[model samples]
Target: MEIDLAGYDGVIVSPGVPLNRHPIAAHARAAGVPVIGDIELFAQARSELPAHKVVGITGTNGKSTTTALIHHILKTAGVPTLMGGNIGLPILSRDPLPEGGVYVLELSSYQIDLTFSLDCDVAVLTNITPDHLDRYDGLEGYAASKARLFAMQSPDHVALVDFQAEADHAVLDMAPDGLGCLFLDDVPVEGQENWPALQGPHNRQNAACAIATCRILGLEDDAIEQGLRTYPGLPHRMERVAEKDGVLFVNDSKATNATATAPALAAYPLIHWILGGRPKTDDLDDCAPHFDHVVAGYTIGEAGPMFARILKDAGKTVTESGTLRQAVRDAAAAAKPGEVVMLSPACASFDQFTDYEARGEAFRAAVEAL
Candidate 1:
C-alpha cells in the first residue's frame, strides 16, 4: 500500500499509522517528503484562511470529548470549525476553511509522532496516564509521546494543561520554565453547575480545559459560558442510555483501561458494573478505590473468568456473564431500584467486537430487550 509521495506536497498519514514502528517514517524521510499528521495539514491549511484558528488536544483520556466540545463551542458562537485527527476523518480529505473558522483536532501519540512542524494556536494536554505501553517502551516513553504535543508548540502559542494529579504535574514539570502554560486546575469548575451533561469531576476538568482554551482564543466571557451550556456531549463516554424500572443504564464503553473507567464508577453511588474484555494493563488497581460503588460485577468476554476471580476476591458479588448481551440481561434482572447498570469495560474491545461502539450497541440492544 505504499505510494510515492515525491509528487505530493506533504504526506497526510492516518492516525492509526504507527510511524514509530512502521516503514512510512523511513520512506517519507528518504523521499524528502514532509510526513505530517492530519493536525499538521489542518494547521498549515488554516494559514491561508482569514482569522482561522487551530486547537489541538492530546491526552491519555478525554481527548475525543474535549476536542468535540471545543468544536461545539466555536460552532455555537457562529464560527465555522472542523474536528478531525485521531477522532477519525483524515484532515486532507476535507476542504480548507474560510475566514473565522477554527480547526479542532483530537491528536493521538501516533499522530503527534508524525507531525514535526505543527504549531497549534491553542494546544491542550488533558492529562497523561500509562497507555499504549506496547507501542512505547514504558511509562516514561508513553509520557514522552504525550509531551511531544507541547514540545512542538511555539513560544507564542498557549498550552492548556489539566494539572489535577501527580502524573499531570510530571508532564507540566517537563515543560520549559515560564512557558506560559495555563493550569486547568486554577479554573473554577464550580461555575458550570448548570451543564448536566458535563457533570462529574472528569468532565469538570475537561470543561476547565475547554474554557481556558476558548478564553485564550479571545472568545468573550458570555460566548464561553453560552458555549459550555449548549455543548452536547459525545456518545459512548458517560452517556445515559435509558432508565427502566428505576435502573439507570449508562454506556461508558470508551473506558478501555482502568484509569479511564475509574471516573465513571466514581460518578455513580450504586453500580451493577459490566466489565471485562481483552484485558489491557495488569490488575484493576486504579479501579479498586471505587469498589464501594459496585453493587454487583458482571464479567464478560475472554477476560470474564479472570475478572470474576478478582472481583470475588475483592468481596464484590460477581457473575460470569461471558457475552455483552448476557451481561446486560443478568445485570438488569438482578439490579435493584436506584442502581446504575453501567458498561465500563476497563479493557480493549478487540476480544469480542470490532470496537467499543459495537459493544455499546450490543448493550443498548440487550437493554431494550429487557
Candidate 2:
C-alpha cells in the first residue's frame, strides 16, 4: 500500500491502527491532508447523491443486530434501504441508491474515530459498555468515541440511545437538545417474545432502538412489528446452527467478549457452553449472572486450561476440550435432548482460528457432523 496521500484529499485508517503510532497518519496530518473514514466519505457524498436518509448505529455490543433490524424494518415498510459499513460491504464501495432510500450504517468505535463530519439523520446508540480498553484510557474514553455519533449529527436528526443502570446515564445526559433524543423507555417494547431471530434482553434493547428509528422515519407500528417478525438473523451472532433430536446447537462465535456472550447464555437453560479461545478478560465476571444456565463448559484454545480452572473454582463442571471440534463433540454428548450446545466463546479466536467467522464455521461443521 502507498504510504503517502499523494493526490488524495484524505486518508481513512482502520480503527485497529493506532494513529498516534502510525508514521503514514502523522505524515498525512503534517501534509495538511484530511485523515477521515468511510463515514466521513459518506457524509461528503450525501449531497451529490439521491434524496435519502442515513441511520448511523454504534455501541459496544448489539450494534450489528440493531443495524440490520432497522434496515429490515425500513425495507419491510417499503422504503428502499442498504445495509453496509462494518457489517457488510464497505459504504464507499456501494453504488448510489434510488431517491428516498435509507442507508443504515453500523459504525464501530474504530470507524467513528476516523470519521469527522458524518451528521446522520438518525444516530442510534445501542448502549455503551467497557470495550476496546487497551486502545483507550478506560470505559469513559471508549464511550466518548461512541457518543461522537450523536455529536456529529445535525440539529433536526433523531437520537435513540439505551440505558444500562437504574438511572439515566450521565454520559448521554448531555445529548444535544437541538437533535431529538429518546431513550429505550420512551418507546414501548411490549411484544418482542415472538421475534425468533431477535431473542434475549439485549436484543429487546436493540429492537427498541430499531423501532424508534423506524418511527422517526415515518413507518407504521404494524409495519415495524412485521419487520421484526420477518427479519432473518445475522450469521454467527446468536444464529441457530442445527437441531439433532431435541438439542439445539447455537453458533455465537461473534460473542468475543463477556458482555456479548452473556445474552447467549441467558437464551437457554441447561446449556453445554463451549467457551474460551484467547480470553479477553482473566475471568468471565460479566457472564456471572447467567452461570446458572450453563450445565457445563467445554473450554478450548489458549484459554482452555485457564477457563477450566475458573469454572471448576466456581463449582461448575468444565472440560479442557482444547479445540472447536472436540468441544462440540463433548458438549453435544453431554447435552440432554432438551439442552443446548452453544459455541459462544467470550474470547477472540486468533489463538486457534483466523477469525470469528472461521471459528463459527468450524462449530457449524462440527455440529453438522453430529
Q: In candidate 1, which residue pairs clash?
A: none
lDDT of candidate 2 vs native?
Answer: 0.85
| Per-residue alpha-carbon lDDT of candidate 2 for residues 1-370, written as tens digits (9 for 90 to 100) | 6565667787776667876577877788777897787778788888999999999988777889999999888888889899988989987888889999999999998898888788889988877766778877787777777877777877788888775621433555445677777877678897877897888887888888898889899998999999999988899998988889899889999999887898988887788999999987898988889999989999999888988888898889998898899998898888889888999999999999999999999999999998
Give the number of the best model, judged by lDDT: 2
How many clashes does each candidate structure show, in the order listed? 0, 0
lDDT of candidate 1 at residue 273, scale 0 to 100? 98
TM-score of each: 0.85, 0.89
Candidate 1 per-residue lDDT, tens place, 127-231, comes to 876777878778887777777777767777778876653344466555545567877778876566777567677888888888888888878878888888887
Give the TM-score comparing model 1 with the true structure, all chains together. 0.85
Query: Local error of candidate 1 at 235, Å?
Result: 2.1
**Error in Å for residue 14 of model 2:** 3.8
Q: What is the lDDT of candidate 1?
A: 0.82
